[model samples]
Target: MYLTPSMAKLVHEFNKLPGIGPKTAQRLAFHILKISATEARVLASAIIEVKDRITNCPICYNITEDSPCSICKDTTRDHGLICVVEQPSDIIAMEKTRVYKGDYHVLQGAISPLDGIRPDNLRINELLMRIQQEKVKEIIIATDSDVEGEATALYLERLLRTMVARVSRIAHGIPIGSNIEYTDEVTLSKALESRRIL
Candidate 1:
């Protein structure tokens, strides 16, 4: 199967993206080819614009167009309460809930010995610095319920126990509307352990 130089280049670029298989890359390349030149240019420009404008917030390490990010800047939000997460995407998920009214601290990544990620690699020191500087009353570990997320949360809890007034982990369990029969063993156990009295 021979592809033109330009088409091959496009396919290669698309394949570089995570979870994009060769067939999907080829499909994307063909879709790009089918689109008008103006639309293609717009797509290219949007990518370039994001690369040029987007950057991490210095305080919380969340991806943003500004340095501090809007969340860090907002005085109306509860700066005393900090919800710490492993990635910027997790912050988006939390925001979608719309019930939380506090600040966030993105650790950039979780500790995973298999992946060579350690405490030094994450923003742990920065979090400690924020605790010392800011009048934070509570620290909520909002990492994923996976092994790496648990490890990172435990490490943070141990480090922050004496420093902050309260340290807690976000409850992990089967999601709302999910069937018990469909849920995994660990999820069911966690749900049972975290159960509350109505």
Candidate 2:
């Protein structure tokens, strides 16, 4: 099917989004065309609003509309404990659990040499500066369980171990309701390694 120039432009812009393929982008573009001008304005305004207002927290680098994010401003939480993650989105996942009452640091991305992302490309210096300036007692590595996540965690560990704080990685293993028999080798290995005395 041949798209008009306008439709093609819309599809092209949508295709630039992560996880959006040509077909999906085309579908989304068609959906946009179906919506009312008011709805389109609302959607477009939302995107623009986020880009204009959201900024990284000065202390932790989490996305925020305020100067520092609420988590960073909350002095009741443990300022000395920091949970490190790849992105600000990860902080949302951690917050949903309500188990951690500590501060956070967003690395913004993981270490992926293939993508040309290195330690210097991340907010690592900021993290180290936070450790030195604050009386931090622990640094938790909560990156994803991928190869890049592992590399980033290892790199952070080596640097953090020399600090006065305890450095630890979040355990990776089988999820709830999953069968051990069907588990992959890496998952099984991690599960076994993370086991504690009953």
Whole-model Cα lDDT per candidate?
0.95, 0.94
Model 1: lDDT of residue 152: 97
Q: Model 1, 17-84: lDDT tens per residue?
A: 99999999999999999999999999999999999999999899899998789999998899999999
Which residue ranges in model 1 land beyond 4 Å of their true spot? none
Candidate 1, residue 10: CA error in Å?
0.7
Looking at candidate 2, what is the lDDT of residue 196?
Answer: 94
Best by lDDT: 1
**C-alpha RMSD by candidate, in order:** 1.0, 1.4
Q: lDDT per residue, candidate 2, 76-183, as tens digits?
A: 999989999999889999999999999999999999999999999999999999998999999999998889999999999998899945998998899889899999
Q: How big is the positional error of residue 162 in model 1, measured in Å on the Cα after superposition?
A: 0.6
Worst 10 residues of 2 by lDDT: 164-173
